[model samples]
Target: MKYSILVMASPTAGQGSATAVSFARSLLARGHTLHNVFFQGDAVGNGLANAIFPQDERNLVGEWAALAEQHKIELILCISSALRRGVLDKVEAHRYERAASTLHPAFTIGGLGQLVDASANSDRLITFGH
Candidate 1:
């Protein structure tokens, strides 16, 4: 089966984003294909590369990056949401005249069209938050 995931939860606040990652792992373990992971709203925080988690806490952003790298999964963040939340890629940061970008290299900034494309191509469009 083919699946695409949409996560709208904050990366640091609650379980929604973590649950999405775990669910993605389970899907892959079951021989499912992950088409992409779209981080909308607060979920875009999951792509922030500079997030410093405490030693005792799970590094969710790192986990997402590793998963994407290992599985060749596309991790897409909503461009608008990400920018509004200060999560910029190198190009975006330069365009906005910022000093640097904070987006993880594993993720890409995209629009809603990518989400639509994923939904159209995949068998399931699973959403993790409201």
Candidate 2:
């Protein structure tokens, strides 16, 4: 089956992101295809390039990046939510006259149309929330 995930929680603030990551890995290990992983609301913060984690803690951002690279998963961050949280891509940064873009390499900044398209294209759209 093809799966699309909707994450609605911050990576560091709650278990939602972790749960989503685990689910994605398990799905892929079971030979399922991941269509996309859409980060919305606070979840968009997960794609911020400036996110720093303590040395003692697991690097959720890095883990997600590695998983995305390994699985060739499409990581889409909601542009509206990302901007409101100060997560910007190169284009958005230039347009807003920002110092630099904070969007990470592992994710793409996209509109809700991507979400709509993923929903229409996937066999399942799972949501991970609070």
Candidate 3:
């Protein structure tokens, strides 16, 4: 099966995003394909590269990045939601004259159309959030 995951939960505040990652892992383990993981709303924070977590806490962003890297899957963040929350990629940062981009290299900033395309192309569209 091909799956597209939509995550709307805050990366640091809740379990929804983490649960999505775990589910993605299980799907891969079962020989399924991940079409894309779309980070919408607060979940776009998961793509921020500079987030600092407590030493004892799980680095959820890192986990997501590693998962994307290991599986070679697309990790797409909603450009609108991300920019509103100060999560910018290099191109967007330069375009908006920001000091620096905080987006992780493992993820790419895309418009909502990507989410729609992923949903249309994938066999399943699973969402995790409030």
Candidate 4:
């Protein structure tokens, strides 16, 4: 089945993001097709370029990024939520007069329209953490 994911929790908030990652991987392994993952709310932290996690702990951001890379999935961060949380890409950072880009390269900034399009295009629209 063709699927898309909507993640709404921060990686550090709880296990919501982690669970989403695991679920996504499982679906793919079972022959599901995932092309888009939309990160909104605090979940946008998953696309932070400078986040550092301890060796013992899981770096959820990197995990999600790796999944996107390996699966050819589009990791999209909601532009409104991203800007509100200071997650800026190179173009946005420069446009907003920021010093540099703070968004992970694996993810792209997008509007809610993309979310709508994903929902319309995919057979399953799975959501995590509200």
Please provide, for model 1 over 1-130, each residue's C-alpha lDDT reduced to its tens digit, 9 standing for 90 to 100.
9999999999877799989999999999999999999999999999998899999988899889989999999999999999999999999999999999999999999999999999999999999983
* TM-score of each model, in listed order: 0.97, 0.97, 0.97, 0.97
Record all residue pairs in model 1 with backbone atoms less than 3 Å apart, i.e. clashing. none
Residue-pair clashes per prediction, in order, are: 0, 0, 0, 0
Please list the residue runs of candidate 3 whose C-alpha ends up more than 4 Å from where it truly belongs after superposition.
none
Worst ten-residue run, lDDT, model 2? 56-65
Let me know the TM-score candidate 3 reaches against the reference structure. Answer: 0.97
- Runs of candidate 4 with Cα error greater than 4 angstroms are none
Go through the candidates in order and give each one's C-alpha lDDT. 0.94, 0.92, 0.93, 0.93
Q: Model 2, 71: alpha-carbon shift in Å?
A: 1.2
lDDT winner, 2 or 3: 3
Q: Can you give the lDDT of residue 14 in candidate 2? A: 75
Task: List model 2 lDDT by residue over 5-88, tens digit each.
Answer: 999989988798988998999999999999999999999988988889999987778888999999899999999999999999
Arranged by lDDT with the best first, the candidates are 1, 3, 4, 2
Give candidate 4's root-mean-square deviation (CA, Å): 0.9
Query: Which residue runs does candidate 2 get wrong by more than 4 Å?
Result: none
Write down the RMSD of candidate 2 (Cα, Å): 0.8
